[model samples]
Target: MPDLSSFPRHSWLRALRQGLSSIESQSLGYTSPKGLPDARTAVSDYLRRTRGVLADPQRVVLCSGATQAIALLAHVLRNRSVAMEDPGFWLHRMVFRHHGIEPLPIPVDDDGLDVTALANTTASTVLTTPAHQSPTGIVLSPARRTALLEWARAGNLVIEDDYDAEYRYDRAPVGALHALAPDRVIYLGSVSKTLAPGLRLGWMVLPPDLVRPVVSAKSLADTGSSVMDQLAFAALLRSGDYDRHLRLMRRRYLARRNYLLHALREYLPDATVLGAAAGVHLTVRLPDDCDIEDIVRRAASRRVRIDPLSWCYTEPDCAPPGLILGYANLTESQIDTGVRAIAAAVGHSSQVVPDINGKVAPDSGP
Candidate 1:
């Protein structure tokens, strides 16, 4: 079994210190249904300056996290079909199921989501990650962006989940979709990826028509997120600590990414690594002979945690076979040892299923 543990970091300590060191703290009480004003204002300013979201403090609905935002939107936009990238974050698909909304698995290529295909569907709402797309790390083509916005203008609600837009290695990250069509795109983001996942802080920039309904859903969900944390986040953002953390994280993840690639080439050269363009995790496709499920089990048995490629799919989708390697939690030494263990566990053996569906010749081309 491969020893594939996650990347490790200490971002939460910084935020915790910041939170604990507040000069005068308020009571831990129910937050405003729309979220604390300062938090919303902070997020609005961050999006404008960082993500280029054309939004006001009034439009930012702070939620428990991006997942909560998805659920809230699913509830508010009932009966309206929602479309998402097929090999997307599986939790998003589950949220739609729980809310009685159909999560249409729209196909994603190297160019990003097939916006034309999404437009051809009967969905009323579309969920997208335009900046450093998840699972496949491909930037959405500019043509697709224009087409999707045009479709949204023609009467489709585009829920933009700017989940992991902060880290970009190749070039400066692209601007937000809401900046171009604020009236049609509902922008969502969270500190889960930036500060830490434990914080559970995320915000949504709802369309004018969605503001009330989304807020109502949020009010019912949990009466809003932690007020203290929200205020603390606002302080962090206003103080420029949040952006500083992002820049710091980008440098760290970039190094980890380089290490993983080097280790793979030196260790598992037969493996194909994709989606290294950006984001916290990269996808590495295994040869067809690899028993993905068995590989996961073996990795776990070896005391390493790895997410299987198939785990992200509810329905069969066009995702190549690979594991989503999150290098945000493990150190380089751990990564090296883990990948070597993975190579050992996988052994020089390919567990190819006896079918042409997923064939991986031991010596294959990229």
Candidate 2:
């Protein structure tokens, strides 16, 4: 839910119209597997300027979305084990599993993915969300970043997921890990966050060695992505509309994030808030004794949909309980209402809570 409410409808319509008008006759028939040249160039330039990722247009492969980018990698890198953060994105693990590649889980702490632990694993590849780590929102520290790169250079490969790197609040934006060692890092990003997920547009900046195989995989995946959308995106990028949209949404999301934080402080003050400085979602660490399933049921009963952080783990029973609250798509009032509901669900509020979904029984720590 990447703030679709604030999507620039008028600007996109304008750009789309312009893009369609400018589309050459030949472009309508068939396009390169590497994607529309205009879109690729625009994406490369935008990434280089914003994320400090030195990407060449030729090396950029536009895919259906980031999921497809990962799938393409899975297809190309078959028979190899990939290490992912223990409490990382669940879909990454599922996608790898679908491709017969079982991912080794490396525990992540406040410092981001434990690179030292990753070094000890026999896995040669690691997929990481370093910019603002998914769910945890912990930025990879400078020391860990260097160590991770050193590990990557030592006959290892890194898949950098720059998922929600655009919306940072507290600190200066951290440059993409690809910048440190482009040869070892495969950078992945998607318009799914900035634009609409329905558009299903994404790009990957691959290492030179990977350009051909991934492109071949993509060619077999769908021939190519929708050409019309790519053209419109290129136009949006070229006309400065995309940057303007991001800037506008950044301020709006920051406000929504702040409101949620303030509400949480007022209500669920005991719950620890993580990764609130950036990204569309925030992770709330609950007491270890709390039953996450019961809380989720209670939240659902109240019409508030909150995701359980435990789902991201390979073994849910062993993981600490937390909630991944997405604030970008909800209004301030809705956020307040949702937090109040969660507080009530978790017994944080003094109000006599309803017997909703039966009460959550406490558990002694293992």
Model 1 steric clash pairs: 2-342, 6-330, 7-329, 7-330, 8-329, 8-330, 288-360, 289-351, 289-352
lDDT of each: 0.76, 0.88
Worst 10 residues of 2 by lDDT: 349-358
Model 2, position 213: C-alpha lDDT score = 96
- For this target, which candidate reaches the highest lDDT against the unseen true structure? 2
Error of 2 at 341 (Å): 0.8
Model 2 alpha-carbon drift over 4 Å, by segment: 348-366
Cα lDDT tens digits for candidate 1, 256-345: 889988888877778888778778788888887776766677677768888877766656444456888877778898787777656654
Worst 10 residues of 1 by lDDT: 1-10
Kindly list the per-residue Cα lDDT of model 2 for residues 127-232, writing each as its tens digit. 9999989869999988999999999998889999997998888788999999889899999999888888999999999999999999988888889999888888
